[model samples]
Target: MKTGVLLVNLGTPTAPTAKAVKSFLSQFLHDHRVVDVPRMLWCPLLHGVILPFRSPKVARLYQSVWWPEGSPLMVISRRQQAALSEALDRAGIRMPVALGMSYGEPSMATAWEELKAAGVGRVIILPLYPQYSVSTTASVFDSWARLMKKERLVPAFRFIHDYHDHSGYIQALADSVRAHWELHGRGELLLLSYHGIPQRYQDEGDPYGLQCHRTSELVAAQLGLERHQWRTTFQSRFGREPWLQPYTDGTMQALPGEGIKRLDVICPAFSADCLETLEEIAEQNRSLFLAAGGESYHYIAALNDSPGHIQLLMDLVCRELA
Candidate 1:
């Protein structure tokens, strides 16, 4: 059977400019699943106030992590696509692999069209998020649904919602951590940090937080680390609302004072390093730790285009195809 694989990510700005950031934020924050406030109260607040005031600051954050190739998220995501395609070819799966960004360039519509043009009869969508959330996974599905509505012929479809508990995925994460420690030596403590969502989301039955903790525990167990040796935290909170805690920045800032001199941080929730992992965790949070009396701070890179990660992704795709 003819099959196509579509990989989607959260996306990044085309450029580190106010205009570009504004456009990116406009799409990102406007999603009802993201903001969750009633449109009557949220729409004006988003475009009128938040975009104007926050765009330039957010643009600066993007500038800090912007690479010669482009946003790290897009760059690594493209590399992942290439790696997965190569793996599939080696496995004798001749399928078209396309990358889509849920909120920016290489959009869902374009990816779907490419699959259609390639004469695919079945399409499998794999969002890069390891833990499922309505804001992330469901949003991807919503985009696909919209695209399918106008299609002359809708292909058979399947979605890989979350692979947090996948053995290959957990092994890939453990491998990355081990590789990092092998080169730099183990830190005084290892911090598993995932992106935070509003407490309201979890209260409303989001499984994201629970799955993140499960991934952390599984990875820690694989490393044979004690409970106190590693812990999980959340980051990237916005607004005055409560979010999943202990917050990553707060933990980093407090660790040094608590006599934890050296630390290693990893964001397993992200399949690829983006502005959140690069600028926020590696740069900003690193500085926060160092300035607050930390002797050494290391940021473990995300599993982006790594051999193990590619294999894990291929395993997930093949399982879905089978």
Candidate 2:
């Protein structure tokens, strides 16, 4: 059967505007997998309070990091899509490789149509989240399932849950860090800052937290980092309620106070540098650390379309195809 690969990411708003951000956030935050609050309570807060308050502020944040070409996430994701397709082509694998955003344009439906147009009879769903969260990977699956239900003849599907502990992934992360340190100087501490899910989610049996830690450990080990030299933290916390800790912003502030003035941070959970990595970590957290007396702060870029990353994607697809 002819097979196509669908590359999925969490997605970003089409533009850096209040209307766009509001629309994007509305669909994103409304998902039960993401928020998990009872609709009766969450709906009122989400529609009345959170959306009204956050939309403009969040749009401003996106504006600061928006690329001239488009949203940074979307631009980079497109590059990644093209790079993976080229890699697959070089490997003599002729198949459609389409990009889909879970919450925005170039939706799953669009991607499926692209595949269908290419005469694809099967699909390999690859979510870019290295760590599987029900909020993320499963949400992509939910989208795929919904699309399938509407089709009179459903195509064969194979979904990749996560690659948190993949050897190629670990080595790519380590190599990126090593390259960063070689170009820049090594910092006192390497912080693996992953996007946070609620602590309640972990308590309720989401393996995301565990997978984040495992990815951190493997990356550190590949880099030969000592226990004292590396630490795992969580970033981009959403709500007032408890999420993963040590919170990245909090950790940044505390690290300066702890006398670790030189620091390097990388987000393992992010497949591309989005608002979170660019604005939140690079700009906002850097300001927080510097304001708290940090002498130097460095943010390592994500493995976006790097040779190693493309190879890793190519291997994943090849494995499934073989």
Give me the runs in candidate 1 sitting further than 4 Å from their true place. Answer: none
Which residue pairs in model 2 clash with each other? none
Q: After superposition, how far is residue 214 of candidate 1 from its true place, in Å?
A: 0.1
Superposed on all Cα atoms, the candidates' RMSDs to the truth, in angstroms, are 0.8, 0.7
Per-residue CA lDDT of model 2 for 1-322, tens digit only, reads 8999999998899999999999999999998999989999999999999999999999999999998999999999999999999988888889889999999899999999999999999999999999999899999999999899999999988899899999999989999999999999999999999999999999989999999999999998899889999999998888799998889999888898789999999999999999999999999999999999999999999999999999998888888876
lDDT of each: 0.93, 0.94
lDDT of 2 at 192: 94
Candidate 1 residue-wise lDDT, 1-322, digit = tens: 6999999999888999999999999999988888889999999988899999999999999998899999899899999999999999999989999999899898988888788889988999999999999889999999999888997878898899899989998999999999999999999899999999998999999999999999999999999999999989999999999999999999988998889999999999999999999999999999999999998889999999999999999999989976
Task: Provide the lowest-lDDT 10-residue window in model 1.
Answer: 108-117
Candidate 2's displacement at residue 260, Å, is 0.4
Over 4 Å off, model 2: none
Model 1 residue 2 CA deviation (Å) reads 1.1
Clashes of each: 0, 0
Give the TM-scores of the predictions, in the order they appear: 0.98, 0.99
